[model samples]
Target chain A: MNTNNSGHSVDIVEVTKTFANVTAVHKVSLNIRKGEFMTLLGPSGCGKTTLLNMVAGFETQTSGAIRIDGKDISDVPPFMRETGMVFQSYALFPHMNVFDNIAFGLRMRKLPAKEIKAEVERALDMMKLSGMEGRRVRQLSGGQQQRIALARAIVIRPKVLLLDEPLSALDKNLRLQMQVELKELHQKTGLTTIFVTHDQGEALSLSDRVVVMSRGEVQQVSAPIELYTQPANGFVASFIGEINALPKARCQKSGQDFRFEVCPEISLNGRQPARLELKDGQMVHIFIRPEHIEIAGPRHNGANIVKGNVAAHIYQGTHTQTRVNVPGIGLVELRTKGAAAIDQAPLGSEIALSVPLDEAVILPA
Target chain B: MWRQTLFWVIVSCILFYMTIPAIVVVMTSFNPGEILSFPPNGFSLRWYEKALTYPDFRGAFRTGLIVALISSTLALVIGTSFAFLVVRYVFPGKNLLEGILSSPLIIPHFTTGFGFLLLGAHLNLNQTLTIIIMTHVVLVLPFVARAVYVSLLNIDPNFERSAANLGASPFMVLSRITVPLIIPGMAGGWLVASILSLTEFSASLYVTASRTQTLPVAMYNYIREYTDPTVAAVSALLIIATMLILMAANHFLGLRKILAIDSH
Candidate 1:
């Protein structure tokens, strides 16, 4: 922890992983900067875990190369890769106590007993597991076990830290708490980290940049805000957060501005990046976040407005999800802060909603 | 109530049926009379003294000890390694290899002894101690393999992966993790093979020269020639030896855990 190290950079160059007849990871390439917390986010079977394993040297890539800090380590074994891993199951050695578990890597390096003790104690204090080192792993609770797993990995001060859904097993409250601690740990150590998880919230909240994957291929890679505001494709737009997909919307170019005929009665203004290639009458999918649409009132006239009857108002703790059934547009869900939607627009009542042009994206269908 | 009573009665009857001869042998060993009998006329240690002093008794006892110790040690090493290989790897003919290893448990000892006798003769090593050791090793292999295999099945593959991830070499992982975890099962198998080899009569009879008779074969020959209490005295001593071995095994690795009753 005291070393004058800026952490290692990992470069995955067109790595592919296949198992027997099934290809788990398509040709994928990524460069993780030094001291960056990059997360691989995807659904199950999307090759996120496979990609992480290849970097950790647990799973060999079928083709292509992986380099750490400008050195090729594709042929290195897991133990010699110098990557610390926190497994999904925690995978704590049941036979060893917390102290021994954390001391294992140092011992493998053949460190002196005095140094191993000091390092293990430092890790215990860092993880807030100071006095619990003497206790067996099975006696600790799930959160404590996870803490020990983290402590064990980081005590060695590895070149890169690999976490495979490490906090997925904890309860909801503990998961949020651990998420904050994990972020704090990353900040304190500044270790180059690669986290693999399927939960979008964990990915968005914890990562410096999230790589969204689907069907064994990368869908998009961007910072959390950019990824949410501007998704590269339909899948990324819908997967990151709750989004209303208006499919088969035909785009019409009116001079410079793009208008999309989302429905028979609704012609919505489409907002996209300046360099995007758009053509008239092109079939495209329009994505709008639930919170992006606001309830229209008098003197608040907007560019694109649609009328719909409130189908259902589901009150969440922080906001109410209002499902509106629009004519020729099917059902569109909108998120209104607090209890405003339920009180303002009751069930089966006509409500006018405005969709801002900049808040939505029109992608090729 | 009737079913419970019937079950208890059936269990008691089976126990008595199995233990009656053993009880008779123990009782007759202490009898003052020259002939073996269940009810003793007077309690005496004369038969024990005579049995200990009998010709060739000490030599046969030594032979039994040597063969049991060597065969069980060989079986424990080879069988446990074989069990680990079968449990951990997927290779062609795995099922066939397992079948062949475990077939000895179901095959009759005398038939196995006869098979080994012919093989030993063909190799021109019929009466050597190496043949006895080799035959006994195969005879006890099935028990050791099955016991260790059961224990190996309880281990998770993640443990090995975790060990390797922690920087342990393959040999270190096996010695420090896998072997220590399966010690109870190994001890159980070792004890069983040792006991079986000690009492093995038919196999020893087929392979052993007259000068190298095991205790059981010696007892068999003595019983055929004599009608005294000396055989009973030897049997009683062997029963005590078995009990001592069991107690020692229980002390080292609790017998219940080794037997898989409480392995978890």
Candidate 2:
């Protein structure tokens, strides 16, 4: 909203990218505010990386424009774009030591030797890699190499930092560690970052605003919580996290609530979304999170309750995922924190489940 | 255990059979007499002295060194540029160009030499160093280019894009990133080309003049002239030199990388 933020904003206007025969990215328009960590979240072949490459000037858009800080860089080459991209492989120059790798950009700019040294030192210090300057990239561990790659990119003070699945190469623990470092790095340098990742959990944890994409189209763009709680359509709901998609059901309108009738004769009184104008028997899809499906207790006669036999129990360290097979409603999964659900809902035992859609995403089938 | 032992014995025997000729040549270089005999009666350095001092041998060595240096350098430049073109771009006649350029590796050496000889004669370059050097370059080009091409393929393309993203011009990215990474391949290719050029005989016989003859051609001519150990002495020295060069290259560049051999 302010001039300071607008000064560094990136405005992508109807950007479309195509390969020889395939349209990789459809017309996607989004505005990224300054200093915001915006992430493009999608599955593989969803055009997130292609979109990032277009912004970085590695690939030019077939149509439309990409403006970085209000300057259209469609005709500008990659080197002149002033955008720093950390590649998926880290792409550290294997021939050079860490010092030279970090100083490469400065050398390309023909900076004075003294200033270059100071800048390299500051960057190394910032990444907590001050002593690793003389080490070969092959000698360093994966996490260390990742930090050095970041140091190399940020040392240039690029207009916008583009991260192309940089954390995807690391192990789970290292990935978590780097995610924190990435968040802190974003805060420290206030560089508007456009991150592309297929990991939905990472997208949820990292981004200030998440753009959910599917099949080269932007499905929804909102805050991570809003993306989960209020998905614009069916694709965004199924993508953002673990969700149990209920089978097609006819909607029966009550005064304020809507009842979804299934063959098993279970009434579902869920909040009717404004986008869906329901007649008497209009089919609608119901999506509920694994955590939302709770086990029914005694003295529970709710309309959304259904009976299903527990099919499987997968005990994760933090939470247990239970798969329930309902005859007419198909299979629905439930998540319960800790190992309680594994014993509470025994396999092959009939258990009543309360499928709540009060806070869930309900869309037209 | 018996079968394994027998298999290894047979393998060693076959290897020894293949190496017997080289061993005989090396042993004959130390023979004191004019005619070579197995397990020489007396060791002498006279043949080596004679081989090193002979005017034709000396001249041929000098000419071979010049031809190897110039031809290998030319091959490295042409081969690397060809590799860059073939690997980076797809155009009309790409396959045809590749096939024609790499044909020397498959075509009979004498045929290629004869073709070059005729071409040189047409150009009024007969019996000249230029003709010999041109033949050597053409013969060794496929090897050098293949090495550089493998190196280029192994290079992550992101290295260049990353360099470009960091404010490097197209030339700067190439000079700083791409060139440095492929130096080992270039060195390996140059070494192989030079060694091959120095020792090439079949092709040199057709293209090289008497004055511009390489070491291998001169040795062949000497063999036809007299039954002496002088050619044997020269062959021994060349074998040792080649072994040393290969050992040095392996130590420095990990020849497996240049050869595109996976260790596992």
lDDT of each: 0.87, 0.88
Q: Give the DockQ (2 decimals) of all models.
A: 0.31, 0.63
Q: What is the DockQ score of candidate 1, to 2 decimals?
A: 0.31
| Backbone clash count for every predicted candidate, in the order shown | 0, 0
> Residues A165-187, candidate 1, lDDT per residue (tens digit)?
99899999999999999999999
Give the DockQ-based CAPRI class for model 1. acceptable
Model 2 C-alpha lDDT per residue in residues A1-365, reported as the tens digit of each score? 01123226788999899899899999999999988899999999999999999998999999999998788999999999888899989988887889999999999999999999999999999899988888878778889989999999988888888999999999999999999999988877888899999999899999999999888899999999888888898888888788988888888886876788766577788766756677777888888899988888876677678888999999999999999999888888999899988788899999999877777777887
User: Which candidate leads in lDDT?
Assistant: 2
Task: Please list the residue runs of candidate 1 whose C-alpha ends up more than 4 Å from where it truly belongs after superposition.
Answer: A272-275, A294-313, A325-327, A339-354, B1-61, B150-153, B222-264
